[model samples]
Target: MKRALLILAATAVVSAPALADEALAKAKNCMACHSVDKKLVGPAYKDIAKKYAGDAKAADMLATKIQKGGSGVWGAIPMPANPQVNDAEAKKLAAWVLSLK
Candidate 1:
């Protein structure tokens, strides 16, 4: 019982930021084209994390891509520029996506 309680508490602590970032993503309309574990219009967050694993610059690159949008990386559909998401929110979303690995 004691161990279970501690584990649950730890899980909750770790989940809070993830949940918050997910909410942020949804609020920014990211979820319309992206999902965490599976491909949608865009690649899954997990896949992105896998591809960029061990990349020290992945977070910064992803943040810029999130705000300014990019094409050819994920193919022809293209991610539209997210003018509404500021740098901090974009960075937070990038960190969250990378953390899915």
Candidate 2:
């Protein structure tokens, strides 16, 4: 039973991309402006995911936007550039955002 529980825990960890990415987002201060389900200073992440649901290039575009920042896309409030997050982290964040239900 203990071995089975351990395997289940490992499986959960392996499958929980959103959980891991939420931690990354929090660490990178994304939660300051964006939330998974509701709008904050910025649009909700699930909304972003819904908007880009079918776009194949969304990941790359969003990653670039995260690093460089943009305005007039979602609203009048501009998204500030995140120089603290590297390219890889931006990509991961984009992927995670896009994965939201």
Candidate 3:
């Protein structure tokens, strides 16, 4: 029973990030505009990774940009401001977005 409990704890720890990302996505209302593979109002995650490839600062830059909201880079369709997204969540989303490459 103790070993089973340990395993459950480990699994919870490992799954936390995925849950956080899912929650963050929902909280940020990402589904209304962007997707991991296909273009919506904004470019796809794959396209973002492709554009910012090789840049070490992509996470930082993207996190800030996502929080503040911007446009012209991904076309005239302005990305809506996401003040609801915290810095940690933004960073995770940015990393996940870049990872979609």
Candidate 4:
């Protein structure tokens, strides 16, 4: 029981950041057009991570795209600019999206 409890605690600690980021994404309405694994209106977070893999400037670029919005890269559907999301939150979301496997 003690070992199980320890494992559960460790799992929670390891998973907390992803959960927090997901909550932030949802709060920011990112979920309306995107998802973690599968493609939605926007590309999946994991697909974004794959496309930007090893790109040193991906976080900055993605953050800018998040705030200003863009099209032609993903599809015909343009992503609307999110004026409500500040620079910091955009960066955080970008980092989180890039972190997805």
Candidate 5:
């Protein structure tokens, strides 16, 4: 019983950050255009992770894109720049998106 309880606690601890990051995404309105597995206005987070999977600079590039926005990569529908998301918040969001992989 104690071992089961310990496992539950460990799972919670691991899941908490992921939940928090998702919450952050929602708060930033990222969820309006993006989802975990399904494509919305933007590509799915998991797809982004898969596309950038072995990339050493994905996090940084994604962070920059998060803040500055980019186009022609995903499609013709250019992603407008997010002036609301600061640099640090952009980095965190990018990291979380990449973690979906």
Candidate 6:
């Protein structure tokens, strides 16, 4: 009983951030082209953060790019403009993606 309770408590703690990530990902349509561990059209979230590792401006740059849309950074496939994501949301999403590292 004690072990089961501990497990349940651990799951509850872990699920919060996972749920938050999923919520933001769904809201931003990130699941359409990206995943936490794998790639679809664009790079994986982990790969993106790795590529931009240690850069102070990564959050800002990524947020702008997410809104503006561009290509050739990762590959020929272009990330479409996401007018749906406002600046604040973009920052949140960008920071989340970068946190994948």
RMSD of each: 0.9, 2.3, 3.9, 0.8, 0.9, 1.9
TM-score of each: 0.95, 0.87, 0.76, 0.95, 0.95, 0.83
Tell me the whole-model lDDT of each prediction, alpha carbons only.
Answer: 0.97, 0.96, 0.84, 0.94, 0.92, 0.88
For all candidates, the clash counts are 0, 0, 0, 0, 0, 0
Encode model 6's per-residue lDDT on 38-100: one tens digit a residue.
899899989999999999999999999989998999999999999998998889888888887
Q: Judged by lDDT against the true structure, how good is candidate 4? A: 0.94
Instruction: For model 2, give the 10-residue run with minimal summed lDDT.
Output: 11-20
lDDT of 6 at 21: 65
Candidate 5: worst-modelled 10 consecutive residues by lDDT: 92-101
True lDDT of residue 83, candidate 4: 87
Higher-lDDT candidate among 5 and 6? 5
List, residue by residue over 1-101, the lDDT tens digit for candidate 2: 99999999999987688789999999999999999999999999999999999999999999999999999999899999999999999999999999988
Please give the distance, in angstroms, between residue 21's alpha carbon in candidate 1 and its true position after superposition. 0.7
Which tens-of-lDDT digit does each residue in 1-101 have in candidate 1? 99999999999999999999999999999999999999999999999999999999999999999999999998789999999999999999999999996
Task: Give the range where candidate 3 is weakest over 10 consecutive residues by summed lDDT.
Answer: 18-27
In model 2, the runs with Cα more than 4 Å from the true position are: 1-11
